[model samples]
Target: MRGLIAAAVGALIAGNIAAAAADNSFAVRDVRVFDGDKTIPLATVVVEDGRIAVVRRDAPIPAGLMVIDGHGKTLLPGLIDSHVHVFPGAEADALRFGVTTELDMFDISRDFKTWKAQRTSLGRTGQADTWAAGLGVTVKGGAPLEMLPPGMSVPTLDSAADAQKFVDARVAEGSDYIKLFIETLSEYHDRRTMPTLSRAEVCAVVAAAHADHRLAIVHTQAEWAAREAIECGADAIAHMIPDRVVGTHFIALAKRHHIFFETTDDVWAGASGMDFAQKLARDPRVAPYLSPMQRATLLATEKKVTPRFFPTVLANTRALHAAGVPLLAGTDSPNPATAHGVALHEELQILVRAGFTPQEALHAATALPDAIFHLGRRGRVAKGYRADLLLVDGDPTTNIAATLSINRIWMNGYPVDRTLPKK
Candidate 1:
């Protein structure tokens, strides 16, 4: 049904369209809105005080509200990146592509409380609001430790018994969730190996996180490792393995456990020598926004000489989607050949290739991740939701790629400038 927020029928109204840039109280007429879950064809959406006040069909503009023309455009809830590692300038970069929220897998900024406080009182912000895994739990010297800056010694678990105390410390530091690492695949192509927390340790850490009311997002790169983590009650798997075709048992196990996956498509594609970053750099819609470092990193991000596992990975993802497994769109960005904001759109594109409909892919990026991560009122365009929104030039539901043609944007009810940054 259509939800039209139109100008009053020959009655008094307040400000012109220009005023909506500063005022959140406004209604736009004749736009198709994808409200995260479904579409309201030709609806009027009312935003007041940074929140969606009404979403109805054929509704006259309330008195004293600004009205804008929305012909030939589509509106959607601002996108959410289900997986990212927030570094300096990452959030703003993401926002440029209309990604209003980022779920940070790991960061030790110790500013989560500040972030929480800021979002609760939103007026305007350049960066996307984040909830992070303050420190990922790993072995004493394992996995990402080699990738961290020298002298950065994050906490590690020695045994299952200490899991509770470790989670407590993270909670005290204002970590919004728990990230458990498992990198025990010793048979790499290079024959190099990494230590990992034992299965017992994984189970214990998951229990501790649940006890503290936090979701456990496990990092497992191997198929067996992912299945094992689910057996231990993980809330979500951070990255689905690209090493082999996902088995039916694993799919059934995941479905039975009610577990979801962060679809890190670009990571696997890049590892398989797909040149994902170069593809992004070539997109006219995305290239102009790339910073110098973003450009450099996109080309330099991980690349392997010989392609491997990507075909299998694609097959597994298609199977998972076909089996009705919940998949959240995430690009393990800035890894190799991936940038922040733009990578997420590429991710949705990949999901479409993996058999998700354009609307389903949008849900994975918006409402699904927001609701799964407990980010309140941010993923949908329903009444009482936050007014984080994007208005693009065409129908993304049909073109899928039309998301890049951004028209206007609102973050917490404040219009985004979308100018090129000076970075």
Candidate 2:
């Protein structure tokens, strides 16, 4: 969902740092641990060889090892941003704000190879690990093509058979999931009409992805399109529909099918001419970490209330949550008014406003997204999980904004330098 290359450059630009600790191990003593689902009060967490070695209330602190004081702080699993567009340095920016992993919804950059290599190593890279939908499946000249930069092309399908081929090719390309652009929303703030894949084509791609053992995520913004996606058995929906109030029937259908959603509220707020993005950018807690691109992108969004569907977006999110549906916190970042890490924190607050307790909202950003997308061994602070953790000033379990009070962050058990980047 990111914009122009120049704008991306501004966000990705960062101040650099040196290598990891000599042994890549440490311990956080006497901390309140949010182990993704529940809380562990006054625990000692040991990290060794880039994974959690021990988690106990009174774990032995080995002599001669580095120990970070966790007094008055809450430690949580480093965040997993459910949706983003990864440009270079995007991962670093995410890590700067405690997001250790990213679920990239769409890209043609083919950086997943490098991402995998970096993640496999135990060295400190100061970047978030990533899983991407390398090239989304769409009709020829479909949804994103209109949104993409000029001359940038992704493979397209003509029929259901073509959709099948695209699925296989996407799998071969190392896409972590399948993305189907099924957009046909009759109205939008942008007011740009584009072609979308048909129901048969959407079904073909979803079926093939399942056969290949890939999760299929559909991009739809209308109630009808979402209904079709659920019936076609999409693993998830990319964005909440904004055109109208979501119905009980649809909520039941989603639950029956076990469909999770990525809440890209920032994207729709910009679309509906709301100041949600601007207000978040101006947040005193969040503003200091903004890169030049984040500042530019956030402030440059159009300020018109085209179509005015912002209320419906919030209503649907509340309705869905009230029905006990799992919602993942995602900012379609580097999009119009959304930046990478900063936008995700804003989403946590928005979820809280939508009736999610701070703890439940934290789960949406941490455990839920990781499990829903099958990102293994990195979403919790339990023993043997990857040692990607965040230490913040206040207990985020009680106040979601406490996530932004980041005191320290670790990726693969190596301390991350949280200093603002020197663009």
CA lDDT, every prediction? 0.84, 0.84
Superposed Cα deviation of residue 353, candidate 1 (Å): 0.2
**Candidate 1 residue lDDT tens string, 1-423:** 122335452222345445546776778788899999888789888888889988887777889887777888889999998888888888888888899988889876767876787668767887778778878899887877788888878778989999999999998888888999988654244776778899999999999999999999999887888988999999989986776788888899999999889988877887778866687898888788777666776777453443666777778789999998889999877787677888888888888888889999999999998888889889999999999999998899877888988888888988887777863
TM-score of candidate 2 relative to the true fold: 0.91
* TM-score, every prediction: 0.93, 0.91
Badly placed stretches (over 4 Å) of model 2 are 1-23, 189-192, 420-423
Candidate 2 residue 146 Cα shift, in angstroms, is: 1.7
Instruction: Kindly list the per-residue Cα lDDT of model 2 for residues 1-423, writing each as its tens digit.
Output: 366776767645531112224456888899999999988878999998889999999899888667888889999999988989888778887888899999999887977688778766767777899989988888777887777788877778889987667788888888889988887546564566678988998888899999999999999988889899999999999997788898889899999999989999878878777777788777776788777877877776755555456678889999999998889999988888788787888788878887889888889988888787777788899998899999999888888889988898888888887676775
Residue pairs with backbone overlap in model 1: 3-43, 3-44, 3-56, 3-57, 4-57, 4-58, 5-44, 301-336, 301-337, 302-336
